[model samples]
Target: MNGRSIATSAMLYTVTAATLVFIAAPLLVTMSLSVSDTQFVSFPPRGFTLAWYGKVLRDPDFQSALSFSLWLASFATFGALVLGLPAAFALVRFPVPGGAAIRSLLLSPLIFPVLVTGLGLLQLFSMLGWGSVPVNLLIAHILVTSPYVVRTVSASLMLADITLEEAARTLGASRWRTFRRVTLPQIAPGVAAGGLFAFMVSFDNYPVSMWLADAQNDPMPMFIYRKATGVFDPSVATVSTLLIGLAIVVVLILDRLVGLRRAMGM
Candidate 1:
């Protein structure tokens, strides 16, 4: 290779290595702290033990928060898919007036500050006299997660082969039939990717859950935040490490089912 090409390749490798270390360092420290035999979060743990993990496992508040988080994420992903798929179809298939504006509005949550969205939802719920905490969380999570579904489905739809749909139509297939047999299969990977993204977003959500949660119904992120800021225990590290492990497992499963490159629209 030429000198210039070698220089560019060296620069890219250095940047990639730096980026990976930057991201992984904190997580590695947290994992180490979780296994350390220390009362407080200390680097270079005095000794290694799994007591912190045991403590987190037995904590009732943690259990409740985890259960609530799982349910909320599941509900939010389902709702996002239901609401977003139709919106995606309309935006992609139909050339409505101000179509770009409508699509932007649908995806505004991704760009808008999450705190602002949470506060706005709080006000809306207060005005409507909605006292149901779980229901409010469900709505907030749906609002945040729906954009992932719309964006992914829109990309999939854009890449889809229109000739197949045309051929199906020419064969006397109904619109719904064509969608189910032809279009749905083509976009299924995108839908699955979107659903996974939505679920992960809702699961780890804190700002919106913080605004909506009551004393009795804290989500996992809120629970973790309180534990980290209030008590500052290594048990929190254990919980975090476990969650990170879960997230990694989920990503591996997704990569197994759909090529990660395709899922990311790369």
Candidate 2:
């Protein structure tokens, strides 16, 4: 190979390594601290033990936070899928006047400041007299996560042949039947990928949830933030490590099921 090709390959390798290190550094530190025998968070743990894991498992507050997070992620993802996929189909099958602007509006959540969205939701809900604990959180999560579903399903629709649906319809198949058999399978992977992203968004979200959830309804991320600020306990590390692990597990499952490379445009 030419020297230019060699230099390009070396540059790519360096960038890849740097990116991996940047992402993994915090996770590695958090995992190490979770095992540390010390009560405080520290790097290069003085001693190692499993007590932090035990403490986390036994803690009711941790359990409640985890449960709330799971519930939020699941419900929010479902809401996004139900809302986004139809909108995607309509946008593609029957483009409206000003459709390009409409698509941008659909994805506004992706670019808007999350903190501002949180404040807006808080104000809107307060005006409507429903700024209670979990409802506000659910509303914010759904808003943030819907964009992922819209973007993903729209990509899948673009890749799928519109003729397949038309052909099915011409052959005595009802539109609903055509979609159920011909259209849905082709885009199912993309939908799943979008749902995975939605779940991850809800799971990892803090900025909007921070404003919405009360002390009683704080999700796991909020719980971690509280502990990190208040107690600085090893269990905070444990909780973070678990959240990271959960994200990895969900990604792996989806990767195996749908081949993440294709869903991600790789």
Candidate 3:
């Protein structure tokens, strides 16, 4: 409506466009490289083909790494949910002494550097004789991912109306029944969002997995790193594109089931 207002709007639009380009440029380049007919990684790819995708898909090592990564992410998400739900309820619903301290302790994993956390876990596990690679990795992942669940679920709990629970209790409903019928529905979006974050974090994790993973239990990130370093080719780009595609699909599904803004506590 006014010159100053128009100028502000134009500046905002420019900044938004620049930010999106900054974020999307790398993904676009990676996707382009994945389809490049060139035998090696190159920008402004010469021609286009999907052979790299096919080759990477058919590779046994790739298949194994993908499978392991999926399994690890699923379990880590589940573990995060298991620990997060009760912690969230307690933090949100109860007036416990030293509540802030407890919450900080639970979320400290997120504050500490992941590389340091991984090293510490590795040393602790060795000292405790926890030799199973998969088990140790799962525990470490759970520790890191649970903080997401705690944060999301606690936010949801704080926003959830207390009246519904009280009304259910007035009707002689048990605590568990009230939670199942009323509380869970309200917080389902938060749980879903938290689980999605946990899964993605675990799937993409390299620093933590680097310390914990063995040759036999290597996840996709480690596998990709090895592939990229060992052979400079489009296949690695193909793998990365597939991962990006997976993340997009997962987000689309979540957005369909639960409004993305609501799920994300926006």
In model 1, the number of clashes is 0
Candidate 1 has an lDDT of: 0.92
Q: Rank the candidates by lDDT, best first.
A: 3, 1, 2
What lDDT score is found at residue 208 in candidate 2? 95
lDDT of 2: 0.90
Per-residue CA lDDT of candidate 3, range 1-266, in tens? 99999999999999999999999999999998999999789888989899998899999999999999999999999999999999989999999799999999998989999999999999999999989999999999999999999999998899999999999999999999999999999988998999999999999999999999999999999999999899889999999999999999999998888766797857
Give all TM-scores, in the order shown. 0.96, 0.95, 0.97
Instruction: Enumerate clash totals for all models, in the order shown.
Output: 0, 0, 0
Off-target runs (Cα >4 Å) in candidate 2 are none
Error of 2 at 134 (Å): 1.5
> Best candidate, lDDT-wise?
3
The prediction achieving the highest TM-score against the true structure is: 3
Q: In candidate 1, where is summed lDDT lowest over 10 consecutive residues?
A: 257-266
Instruction: For candidate 2, list the clashing residue pairs, or say none.
Output: none
Q: What do the candidate models score in CA lDDT, each in turn?
A: 0.92, 0.90, 0.94
